[model samples]
Target: MLSPNTTLKQIEILGYLGTKFPNWIGDDSFNNIVDIKLSGSQHCSNLPPLGQLPSLKILHISSFDSVTTVGAEFYGNSSAKKKPFSSLEILIFKNCHYFEALSMSDGQCQELTYLSIYCCRSFVSFPNGGLIAPKLSDLNIYNCPELMWLPEKMTSLSSLKSLTIRSCPLIKAIPEGGLPISLSKLRINYHQLLRIKWNWQTLPNLKNTLSEEGFPTSLSSLSISGCPLLKKIYDTKDSENKEYWRKISHIPHVGGSSERQEEDSFLNMKQAMF
Candidate 1:
């Protein structure tokens, strides 16, 4: 148990294993803690219920070798009365090999703004039900090979601004509803599942001023690269996928290899056909 007298604004636990933080930290004793960083916890199979800390704003957890399957326990005691991570703004998870599954109760992380997940190869499941991060502005997912879908109800995040998906080879498609119109910059790179024919036919019905539900008209910048199959569709010989083509044509920045994109019929032949 941590001393009832203990009080700190920052905590760091590095290169340690079998470490257990005292539950007493959450009993109104450590409300001032703002930053917690844990790295190289190679043999640590479990984590403290730090979510109960009301003032926790930044959390970075990485390199837990023996840990697998994260569930509500990491959030807080199942019977605890308080909301978890209520004041958190930035949450990051990386380099945890065996960690899989993140199931959190609703109304948590209510003030969150930036969420990132990277290098977690074994991670498969995210919070169940639907994700409700109202203030989330930047959501980045990278190097996660098995995550095939984002939350089903992402449109609830009306404040989202920038989204980046990278190095996740198995993610076959974006969420079914497409992205929130609030998004201004979107980037997809080094993805394998997106490589093959992007089944635009399977895209969710997204709304805009011109259509019922198409791509978000508010999007200003778009980028796509390393998706072989999508590129094939872009450079096909006799093009008829205008609906798909028109969707990204207006976006200002769809970054990729200039040489290949210049040869693309989608871009070069637009004038010839018009």
Candidate 2:
């Protein structure tokens, strides 16, 4: 038995285990912990009691093969009288194939800044209203091929700065006028996307009316890559639409001779069609 005086600040447990984890872990082993990582545990089916770690700032769990369900009270039961990590800043779950949904008993995380879920094949979407962190600034979702779209309530991320989605082959469209005005960098790669249609009027028109007033630019970089099905990116006005085409055409291509020729042919076709 471990002593109660043992205040472990960080713990990483890996490799296969055949026995039930000591329930004492939930009772006494995590009081001072600020970070925890569990990976490659073959027999583990559930998490160590987590809400007990009031100071936990980062949590990463991966490769626990036998776990299939993530319960709404996984953090803590009402009987335990524990709460979510008020100081939690980052959470990452990687390669835990059977884990499906995330449920937060409360509706928010006031301090969480980053959340990343990678290669979790069974997850269908971000959790509903009770699952988001209020101060979340960066979100990355990758290789979850079954996910078709982001949650419709994403605009509630008022402080979001970076959003990246890669290799989700089912996503078909960006929610119309749904991007947060505070977004600074946006990247979408290899999604099964067919078109990007934005209503320019719905977006903040900082440049046109404030050309002389010089309002600070909020959005700086936008990139879309490896989307073979994408055919168009358009604007609300015909004149601005022409400018959009010019911008897309000018984006450089990195390729050998055949690829360059193919790009040239596409450009010629675009010019002819326009």
Report the Cα lDDT for residue 193, model 2.
26
User: Best by TM-score, which number?
Assistant: 1
Residue 173 deviation, candidate 1, in Å? 1.7
Off by over 4 Å in 1: 1-5, 22-27, 190-274
lDDT of 1 at 163: 77
Query: For residue 245, what is the lDDT in candidate 1?
Result: 57
Model 1 weakest lDDT span, ten residues long: 199-208
Report, for every candidate in turn, its global Cα lDDT versus the true structure.
Answer: 0.68, 0.62
All candidates' TM-scores?
A: 0.71, 0.71
| Candidate 2 lDDT over residue span 1-274, tens digit each | 5434448888777884854565555453456878878788778787665655677888888987777666643565455444556678898889988777766545335688998888988777666653466688898887788777676566677778788777777777766447665565555663332344433333352112222213213334334456444334342234545665554443332111123465455555445536
